[model samples]
Target: MPGSLEPLDLGVQIPYHFRCPISLELMRDPVTVSTGQTYDRPSIESWVATGNTTCPVTRAPLSDFTLIPNHTLRRLIQDWCVANRSFGVERIPTPKQPADPTHIRHLLTQSASNSNPYPTRLSALRRLRGLARDLDKNRSTISSQNSREILVQLVFADTGSESSELTHEALALLVLFPLPESDCAAVASNPDRVAYLAQLVQHSSMEVRVNSAALIENVLAGSRTAELRAEISNVDEIHQGVVSILRNPIAYPRALKIGIKALFALCLVKQTRNKAVSAGAPETLINTLADFEKCDSERALATIELLCRVPDGCTAFAAHALTVPLLVKTILKISDRATEYAAGALLSLCSASEKSQNDAVAAGVLTQLLLLVQSDCTDRAKRKAQLLLKLLRDSWPEDSVGNSDDFVCSELVVPF
Candidate 1:
């Protein structure tokens, strides 16, 4: 015979100590054992009283035996126990392993060559995207040199691709990778890396532009004097390019938003500030705000907010009075979600002086904010309204009141 062993029937002769006493087939909640036999509640109590808990078949001693639990059965009992216990503890699922990078590259290669089935390629790419994020999370598991190599590969892959979506995904991974500050410094210092990022900012894809903007922001935040000076030397040309794109009617909304944020950040740097201002940046922003064709209301609002920070620029334009009124109208016309936030910025600028306060009151912002307080809106709006009313009350000349007590009673009431 090729393979033959007679099956032995030990069902009748098996020792009680060797056989698992718990019902292997019909196991239920939290069952315990005495000796080698399993018992339900009533049987257990009877066994304890009679002292006859040895297995009925084997006659093995029942006393002083271990209470070994079936793993699966114990889980069910644990669930019931938890429900009856304290509410503080919580059970969580374990995390899984990240996908392999070599697998990802294989899928990408297959997708490019059209060698694999379309559906499989797409599925593999999706998995690869997830794996990239996971790898970013566990970046510390890899050596710094390896991490840098991977980052460089991603940068190359992102910029070399004609597919906008894939490039955006690759660029996104750059942000997700948790590099140490020193590594960031190294990236910024490396000429090749800087050139690679600068080129990506000019990519045709708006997603690439946005991600590049974020990369630039992160890099510049810790840039050294030499690097900063190099960037500053090119400020006018860069600002003009970015501002042109921002002014373009066909530019993506997200791209324009990022460009505006990046511009604002650049303007905050002392080396870039004067150059940007001299490049007719202020006039360009004012023109954007005035343009009805642009449909960049959010960009316009951001520009206004950024302009407010540069007091000299706001003053130089002779548009201080117009700023508050435009802001108020924009607030009223826009959704209520950002209304109070817009109002707060306007108030901050206008309330800086008694003259400006008078200008704001004349703009009817005070009455508008007061009406907002009466409406059922967010607590933020109500708080802003209260702040505006207080500012208005405080702006009145203190010497104008003969007695402080009268002013207190008339203007503000206090309850005991």
Candidate 2:
């Protein structure tokens, strides 16, 4: 609510009427509520947003939440700023009014109409996206009017014969706000809708593709029924698309993270894990995990652990040239969860082959394991580290390995 105008000289006092009572700053966009009190639009909007039911100044109960723009007061403030230009008070640019609920309703209606031309519907959708991005009030209005359902319906209405632009725009709006679980369930429960989204993950438009990948993740995370989850997990296109996103160099980090989450969700089914392995998910994840700053290391590692539960996942990881070094580097660098997953993946590789064990040792896994065993990571991670130390020690001559102190405890090490 503090005005964005430049500060005025101490000698030049701002008129009391020109200031918002709540912020005590000059009013850039003065608005009067039903209680007859004028305040900055942002300040009063913030107050009402916090569930305040009364006027700040008069303390009167507010039955109406209407904020009437005070044009006269705004004009007066502009004139005052103009008169005091020498005092460093710059004229405030006119502020755009927040979208009215009625206008939002009209746009929603227009955007959802199949009778309207595609161009017309796209225009309405663009405006709605602008409103949702611009202000909290606009989003609330749209959300209250069942925008989620309308957008889902619009996307489902697509028959592949229509322009893809409309479907993409609808998807963009659907992801702009976080849809609750119930809304996600609505999309996930419908086979046609889920199939449409899976297909969209590979769309030519990068924006549309990434949005679809993220929406799939949301649907997976929000699926309440096991049947719905199993249905989504079985989509072969989704698995391939997620792997493609992880491998795509042009894709942004957020998109890659979405793809990773989607992969994690899909691989939850034991049978689907092999499908991901066959789709080269481990190689894509290894590449992603190689760059720590660019992508989510913990999730990428967690998904790797999940993938390694099967023999094919371990074989894929063991064959990768960068697997050992990547896992060795990631240990104890990120969160405790990341350390656990990294250790878990390395252990999976070791359990799979003797060559992988030699690779881990050559890549300096012993030092990392020693440090990991001594450090304050999770108990689960430390137990894995201790088991690794024992495995390495037991595999080779005792004298060739490091001190026995690294073996702080003994625990069974299982492959992820």
Provide the overall lDDT of each model, using Cα atoms, as 2-decimal numbers.
0.51, 0.81
Q: Which stretches of candidate 2 lie above 4 Å from their native place?
A: 1-32, 36-46, 68-97, 160-163, 180-183, 251-254, 291-295, 395-402, 410-416
Q: Looking at candidate 1, what is the lDDT of residue 211?
A: 70
Candidate 2, run of 10 with poorest lDDT: 407-416
lDDT of 1 by residue, 251-330 (tens): 56565555666666566564455555555656566555544323345545554555555655555333434666666665
Give the root-mean-square deviation of each candidate in angstroms. Answer: 17.0, 5.0
Top lDDT hit? 2
Task: Return the number of clashes found in candidate 2.
Answer: 0
For each of the candidates, give the backbone clash count: 0, 0
For model 2, how does the per-residue alpha-carbon lDDT over 243-300 read when each residue is reduced to its tens digit?
Answer: 8887765557566767777788788777778888988898888877765443377888
TM-score of each: 0.44, 0.81
